[model samples]
Every structure is written in structure tokens, then in C-alpha cells.
Target: MNRNIKFDNLRGFSMILIVMGHFIGTTHFTQTYFDFAYTLIYLFDLPLLIFISGYFSKDNPESSIKAFRTIFIPYLIFNTFWIIFIYLTKGYVPADMYLVPGFGLWYLLSLYLWRAFLPTATKIKHIFVISFILAMLIGTVNIDPNFLSISRTLCYFPIFLFGFYFKNLEEKFTIKRSYALLILIPLLIGATLLYLPFNSTILILKYAYASLHMGNLKGMVLRLLFILISMIIIILLNNIMPSKKTFLTKIGKNSMSVYILQFYFVFTIPDIMNYLGFNYVFNSTFLCIFYVIIATALVCFILSRDKVNKIMDILIIRVTKILMKKTTP
Candidate 1:
């Protein structure tokens, strides 16, 4: 299978947005801007990440084992770390507001689940079509929010299947400029409607059963539309600013490490700046941007180091190997 450097770079960029969205979410920003930023992030962030993940799938036992080690193991390790970190910081563990309840590690957990189901999902013709319809139907009914696992799984599983299907139909659709505009225009329209007063009724109905604010018919339409737009923009950007070397590609390769560690900067730096009485200046939107950029660069630099990453990878491998052996025997 041919690796698309373009898609890989786009995936890295999407991760940056995920980090930025989280940062903004934690900060005190204007409600309108915050909502807009969040809508944009939700529109395509995880879907694109999942789609890119599916793009790397191969039908081999070695790749499957690597997936278990690289994806599933890190997911479990990080969830445990998050639990411990929260427990130590606070007297008690709170509900997982980061992604979903009890599963603050939703990103990793969902990806692991989706990947595990890929073998079965791929065999079905029109898997995405079926999943998408079900997602919309479930979104419309207003299910109980307490069943968060079921709600999120229903909402996201379709997109996961969409990505898997996209990988299967890679050559069927051309990434054309016209298709890009077609997707972008509808996305903008849908997003605009979401902020309108008329959308309140639909929004209320949608949120009744799911913590997901964007599960309604209108919202899902916009979400998928934005995913299409994101793909188009990524393709266009890739064509315009084509990388001649493998530098960005290498960075893209290690995006997972960048992702898991980014939270340290997102959550910690703002508090630290406030403590130092630098919050007055550093709390500005511009400063937030600067801090995030610098912090991301610093993180990328640290993770890109051969010695540090090698040690981290070795530890992860050893831990996963032990876990696997214990589970198997």
C-alpha cells in the first residue's frame, strides 16, 4: 500500500487543532468564539484523525500486533496515568469531562475499538451508509445522556466506518477542486444555522439523550460536510505547499507522542503564567497562540530526539510485552 505523505501531514495538522481546541476550551474565551472554535474542531478533528488512522491499515498479523502495541497499549497506559494524575491532584476523581465520562481516554479508546471492529465492518457493503443512518436516527430520538458510552459510540462509530470505507475506496473518488467547494459551502451554511435561534429547538432535542451537542440531523449533516471540506482543504494545501523532503513526514510519524504530551502544556502553562503574575499579558489571545506554538515546538523537539524517544519506545514495548504475555498465558 502506498503511503500518502499528504494525508499524514494533514493528520498532524488535525492533531494540532485538537490540542488548540482543548486549550481554548479550558480558557475563558468569548462564548461566541469558543462555540465557533469548538464547532470547527468537532466538525472534523476526530474524524480526520480516525480516517488517517484507517489509511494505515494493512492485512497482516505483524501490523495487527504493532497496532496492539502502539495504539492499544499507549491508550491503556495513558488512561491509567490520567486516572492517577487526577487522583493525586484532587481528593477524588471527577467525571471524565475531557471526552466522555469514565473514559477521559475517549480518543484512544474509540480508536482502539474502531480498529478492532474493522475486520468485521469492512466485510459489509455500504457499512458507512448503514452506520451513518443509524447514527442520525439515534441522534434524533434523544436517548438518555447517562448512557454516554452508547451515545458516543453510536455517534462516532459511523465516522470511524466512513474512514475505513474511504480507505477501501481510495481510488474511486478524485480530490478535485470542485468537490472541495461543494463540500465547503454546505458546511459553512450548516454551521451558520447552528448558531441561529431556530437551531435551539433542534439542539435541545438532540442533547436530551447525548452529551454530544452535534448529534442532530442538522448537526450531523454539518459534521460530515465539514469532514469533506477538511479533506479538500488538506488536499489543496498539500498540493500548494508540497514538501520536498521528509521532515514534515517524520514529524507526522511521531504525532501520537506529540498528542499525548500536549496536554501537559495546555493545562499547565496557563496556570503557571497566572501564578507568575504574567497572566495579564500572557492571557491575551495572541499570547495564547504564541504559547501554544512555542510549547508545541518544544514538545516536538523533545519527542523528536532519538535518545528520549528510543527510551520511551523501549519502555512502552517492554510494558506491552509483559501485559500481552500475562494476558495470553
Candidate 2:
């Protein structure tokens, strides 16, 4: 089947943002930075990716099997690999890495949870509203993020629902690109300027107000604002996003490939650079930004290649077949 250029492009766009965020964070040296760009990206990148996940979603009970095949199986394989890799490299692995998930692995587990429950979830009327309430409510309890990625899963659920509902929008939604840009650009600027380092945890939705040293009332209010603003950002992005073909189209089409493959590089690049006596980039924001851009371009270029995607596709298919054969009558 032919892929949607726009969808792939958006995935590419989101995937790059994910890379940019992680690259900036994990490499953090004297670049021990928390500024507007980082803050702003954290606010929407994962949620946007989750929304994209739902755009392709269907209300099918059988999708749970698909989720098990694709999302769950890959997550288990990678999670185990990540654990072993960390054990060898870092000297100790987390006891709950598989159940709790690491930073990059959360989305895969969360997506599996979302996909597995989707059919039953869709049957509930007003599920979007319920999901939003759940997102807000989940923030009240300080659930350790390492525990199943449950906090993020609930927090991002409504945005995913919005994307699902958006799939059926038959001209009910229309906006001028000029207008969307007018709204989005200012909002982006406002969000950037308004962001602070301490506020970063709220963006991830992984902790309670107490855990963040915020009052419950204020946290709830801000959380509500974050969710609404993110929706607006996504809607504006949809209206303004270009449909024309570009390199990002291929990157976006094979976005999951870029996503999983980049994990191999995100933490290593900075360390490799630092060990080579190239610490200058970490000292200056400009150099750091430039470094990440070059790194991001390289990752997108190499990881999104057809051959790499084919290999991953083949691996997932074979693994799924094996799992099915072992379990089925």
C-alpha cells in the first residue's frame, strides 16, 4: 500500500523533535541546560507522536493481536537488549527495566497498552473526555515513571483520542495556514519564554504535584492548561503542515525505524565526542545546537534507509510468527 506523504512527514518531524530532545538531554554536559527549546519540545513532542499513533488506529478488537505482534514483541526484545547493554556498559542494570521501561522504551510500552485496550476503550461513549479526566487524575498520584510507563500512558491518552477522532473529521475542521501559523508561532514563543527548568517535570506528566513541589491546586490548573495548549498546538500543526514530498517523507514513513535506531546513538554520540577532546560544543549553546542538528540529520539519513527498515520489518514479522506458532492451536 502507498503511504501517506503528509503522515510520514509529520512522523519524521515528530521523530526529529524526539531525537533533538533526547540528544540535548542525554548528552547534557556543561550544556547542563534547561531552556525554552528543550522545555517547548518536551511539552508536545511525545504527545504529538502519540496523536500520530492514533491517527492510523482503527476500532478493531483484533488489533490487540497486532499490538502484541508489533508493539509488545519489539518492546520486549529491545527492553531486554537495553538491559543487557546497560548492565555491560554501566555495570548495573535496573531490576524493573522490563516492567517499568527506560526513557526511550516507555512510548513502545505505552503504545502497546493503548493499542491492546483500544477496541474496548472505543466502545465507551465520551471516552475522550474520560481519558482527559484520567490524564488529570493520574497526575494526582506520584507513580514512579519506571513502573510500566503508566503515568505517561494515561496523561497522553486524550491526545491520542483526539487524533483518532480527527481521522473521521469530514470537513468539520478547516483552517487557513496563515491563521494557524499566526496562532501557533506566538503560542510557541510564549511557551518557550514562559518555560523554566523546574517546570520540566510537569511537561512529562510522570509525577504528582507533591513530587514536583507544586501545590495540588496549582498543579491541576497547570496540567489542564498544558493539555489544552498542546491540543491547540497539534491542531495548528495539522493545518499548517505541508503535504509536499521531502526527505522527511521517507524518514517519517520509516519513523519507527529512526526512533528505535537513534536509541543506539543518543547517549553514545556526546560521550564519543567528549572522549575525543571535543568538549567545545557542550560549552556553547550555538555549538551544541549545531552539533545536534548535524547529528539529527545523520541519524535521519542513515536510519530511515529502506534497507534498515526492511531488516526491522523482517525481524518483527519473524518474531510475530514465532510467537503465534508457539501459542496457537
Candidate 3:
């Protein structure tokens, strides 16, 4: 209610994590490092995002409507553009256009679906939670792609609901010492799970496989524990390091534009470097990291500038406003 410093900070943090996860994912790395980082990304990246999304849901129908315009419209527009880009560049749209490497707009598609259903979802929280857990159970056991979709939908719904519920709770529940403890407990649990070894023979390649192999009881427990850890870290960070009313907040506010546009840099910048002969200049691991760091910072800084982002902000708002008016009664 009080502008939710925690939620805002968490949103910004999650966006950065998602971006970094993609960067790590796309770069050529040793198997051990990739596997570890990929596993962590799998465990918390999306759940944190969905939780932040839910946190902002609150009780406002208008906000939900705006979220639809902001998330869904851009998702469709960007997806279309990417489809065309792929066709022109590669002569065909890639089969996994939805899974745009380093962009992760597929999450946007999934988020859009959840936002559209939030109205009905908010009304039946327990039913949604139960249904989601059951679906995850079924998906894990059967190993069906359709079931995987259902499992993800179900898993993230509770996060959205938790966000909605927390928005309300902020009014009634003050941040106390106990609240901090509640956050820490789950983090510790998650840390233990990550460190502890399980039977290598039983481990699965896919995330769903790992969950299924863990068995319903352990899988649900681990997943719930991880979600709790993520939520707690978000809350704790918000309480400790609230966003200052500064440039980062402005960037965070316009994060979607930054998000949508960053893909061009992520996908094409390597090629651009190759063309410019920077790739040959920096071929080693240290140089590669330095190059990525410089490139990413340059992209973020350029996009963070007022002139470019202001124009984008104006265009997006005008377009979204028109769509909102048309969609609304």
C-alpha cells in the first residue's frame, strides 16, 4: 500500500537476475559451471518473477487491466517482430521462437495468461493452490509436455496469489523480527537442498524430471521450500535496501521497455563484435567476460538515458492507452 518499496526492489532484482541467467545460459561455459548456474536459474528465477508480479496484483482491477496492456501487447508485438527477424535473417522462424534466448519472453506469454485470469483466480485462492499442486504432481509422474505447461501454470498461480495476499497483508501486518526469521528459514532450507547430494542415478535432465524423481512428497517439499526462500529474500531485500527515488527507480519503472529492447543487443551484439573485429581481440575467457560486461553496461546505460527511453515511453503509453480504451467498456 505504501508504494511497496520491497515489491519494487524485488521486481528490479528479479529482472536483473533473469537477464544474468540468460547471459550465463547462452555463453559457452564448462559443463559443471553451466549445470550449476542453470539449476539455480531453474530453481528460483521464474518463481521470483511470478511472486513479484503477484505482489503488485493487489485489489485493483484497473492495475490488472494495465498489466494486461503492458505485458500482453508488448509480448505479442515483440513475438511478431522476432518472428519476422528470424525469417529475414535465417530464412525461417525458429521452432523455439517462443523461447527467445537471453530475452525469456516466453515468461511474458505465461505471465500474460496468468494476468488475464487473475480476476477469477483471486476469488478462489485455495482451490487454485490445490489444483496447481495436483497438476504438478501429475505432470512430474507422467512426463507429458501438456502436463508440464499445466504444472508451470499451477506453480506460478500461487506465487501471484501470494503477491495479492501480501499486498493486503502489508496494511495489517507490520514488518517484525519474526517476519525476518520467517524469511531466513526458507533460505537456509534451500541452501541445504542445493548443497546436499542425492543419488546421481535418480537425477533427471529436465527440471520436471528432477522433481518427479524426487517423488511427490520430496518434490513438493523442495519446490515449496525454494519458493519460500525466494519470497523471503525478496521481502528482506526490500526492507533492508528500498529503492531510492533515483535513476535506478526510473529505469525500474520503465523496465519493460529496457526488457523488450535489450534482446536486440543480446542476440546481435556478438555478431556485431565479430564484424568489428572485437571478437578476435578478446578470445579468452577473461576477455569474453569483460566484453560481455562492457557491452551489457553500455546497452543498459544507453537505454537508461532519458532521450531514447522517453520517446519509447511516450510511444508505449499512447499505444497502450488506445488499446485500454478499446478493450474497456
Candidate 4:
């Protein structure tokens, strides 16, 4: 597949935001500013990532299997790592260790689910429309949080399909950077302020659940608005950013590594900080933001190395080959 620099840059940018979001979420916060930043990041970061993954997904006989290995295998491996990390660190077994995905690992499971289902789902005409309505309706269902990975998968399925089918939409036009900024700046600010009233619920919607306090109708309306707003923001982001070789572009190319490996740091850093007596210094909102930025860069640098890629290839590629052989007979 030919690489699209614009999408690569977008992916890289989204990954950083995701890392930052996780970092912010893990902090023990009583600060309003930290909550605000975390909410803003949560609003669109993973949705954008899911959409991009769909955009890059190819439809082929082996595509599902390939995507499964590429994503799900790593998820299993890393989730196991997380389980061990938790047991060693906290000295207790979390009941949902195997049943639910560990922090930051659910995306891989969701991605695999989307890819596995998309081939058949995309065959129906007006699928995106149909799937979106289903996504909206899904918000009304009372489901267990243990079912979250699958619930969120079904909810975001429309956006994923939209990305695949709306290929031409990406290049339909480009907005001037100045104009894009002029529009996006005020739009984001206005949306943030308007969304603040429901900020508490808006944060949980990212988990693909209806707001506990809001009615189903209101929840559906707000969820749809989030979908639209997220799409617009991602469009403007892709249009306005420089689509050339840069650090983010480099990070984007190695996104898989960063995505898979960054969770360890995000989950462990607080304890590490506390152990080192730097918790007081690093717990501030500004310092947490700085920590997220530096940590993202460090993760990208460390995981993008050839040695790490080779190790990943061994796990994903080698296991894939083995599975194929076992199934051949």
C-alpha cells in the first residue's frame, strides 16, 4: 500500500493525544484544569484513531486474519504483561484481568473486532447510515461494563465504516491554514464551554455508554453531536497541519510500537513517581502535561528502534505463520 503522508501525520498527532489522555486520566486529580484538559482529549482522540485505522484498512480475503494477528495478538501479549504488572505491583488479582482489557489495550481488541466484522458489514448498501443508527440505539441498551470492549466496538463501527467508504471525501478540498485555524479555534472554544455543563457525562460517553443521569433521548442527541464534532475537528486537523516529513510523521510511521508499548509507562509512572518522592512535583496539571509530552516522545523513540520492531515481528509475524500452517491441513 502506498503511504499517505497526511494520514500518517494525523495518526501520529492522534497517538500523542491518546497518550496524553491516558496520562491525564491516570493522575489523581482534584484540579479543574486537569479535568478540562482530560475531557477535551477524551472527546475525540480515540474516535479519530479508530477512524484512521478504518481508513487504512483494506478489503481482502486475508485482510481480517492479517489485521487480527497484527492487532489482537499484541493485545493478548500486552494484556498478559499488564496482568503480571498489576499482580506484582499491587499484590492482588483483578477479577477482570482476562475478561476485560487492561488500560490502553482495549483499542487493539476493538480494532480487531471492527476489521473482523467490516467485510460482511460493509456489503449492505447504506451501511454507514444503518450502522450509525444502530450505534445510537446501542447507547440505550443496559449492558454490563464487562461487555465494554464489545459495546464500544459496536458503537464506533459506523465511524470505522465511514472512513473506509468515504475515501474521496478526504481529498475533496483543503482549507487554508489561516482560515482553518480561525474557524477551529473559536469552534473548539465554543464547543468546550457549551459541553462543560455535561462535561461529567461527556467523559464517560467515550466508553460507549449512555449518561447515567441523562435521559436516553438527550444522551443520544449529545452522542450524535460528539460524533459530528469529532469528525469536523479531525478534518480540520488533517487539512491544517503540514503534511510533510517531520517528527510526528516519523512517530506516526512507528505508531503500532508506540501504541502497544506506551501503556506500560502510563500505568506505572504514578507509582514510580510516588516511590521516587516526585509525586508532589509531578502531580501538578502543568507538570503532568509536560510529562505526557516527554513520555510520548520517549516511547516513540524507544519502541521505534529496529531491535524492538524485530521483536514485534517475531511475535506477530512468526505466530501468524504458525497459525496459517496449522490451519492449512
Give all candidates' CA lDDT scores.
Answer: 0.59, 0.82, 0.58, 0.74
Q: How far does residue 201 in candidate 4 sit from its true spot (Å)?
A: 5.5
Between prediction 1 and prediction 2, the one with superior lDDT is 2
Using alpha carbons, what is the TM-score of model 4?
0.90
Off by over 4 Å in 1: 1-3, 31-35, 59-67, 94-104, 140-149, 175-243, 282-285, 300-308, 326-329
For model 1, residues 3-63, the per-residue Cα lDDT tens digits are: 5677667666666666666666556655554456555565556656766776666534454
- Models, CA RMSD each: 4.9, 2.1, 5.0, 2.5
Model 4 stretches astray by more than 4 angstroms: 199-201, 204-211, 282-286, 326-329
Q: Output candidate 3 Cα RMSD.
A: 5.0
Best candidate, TM-score: 2
Residue lDDT tens for model 2, 274-321: 899998778777887788889988988899999999998998888777
Top-lDDT structure, candidate number: 2
lDDT (10s digit) by residue, model 3, range 1-329: 45655455555555555555555545654445444544554455566667777766644466567667777777766777778877876698766555442134655666776777777666775754674565346436545333224445655665666666776576444466567667656664566457345432121122464543566667666566555555566555445445456434555555666666777767777777778877653447666566656665666567656687688767767877776666535
Cα lDDT of model 4 by residue, 1-329, tens digit = 77788787888888888877777667767487776776677667877788799888877767787777777777777788888888898897778775788876777888988887777776778887887787788778777644447667767787787678657676674678888888888777766766766645454444334436667888778778877787777777767878677777766777887788888888787788889998875657677667767876677678766678678777877766765555564
Which residues of candidate 3, in runs, are more than 4 Å off? Answer: 1-6, 31-45, 58-68, 94-103, 131-135, 141-151, 171-207, 210-219, 274-283, 313-329
lDDT of 3: 0.58
**Candidate 3, residue 273: lDDT:** 74
TM-score to native of every candidate shown: 0.74, 0.94, 0.73, 0.90
Best-to-worst order by lDDT is 2, 4, 1, 3
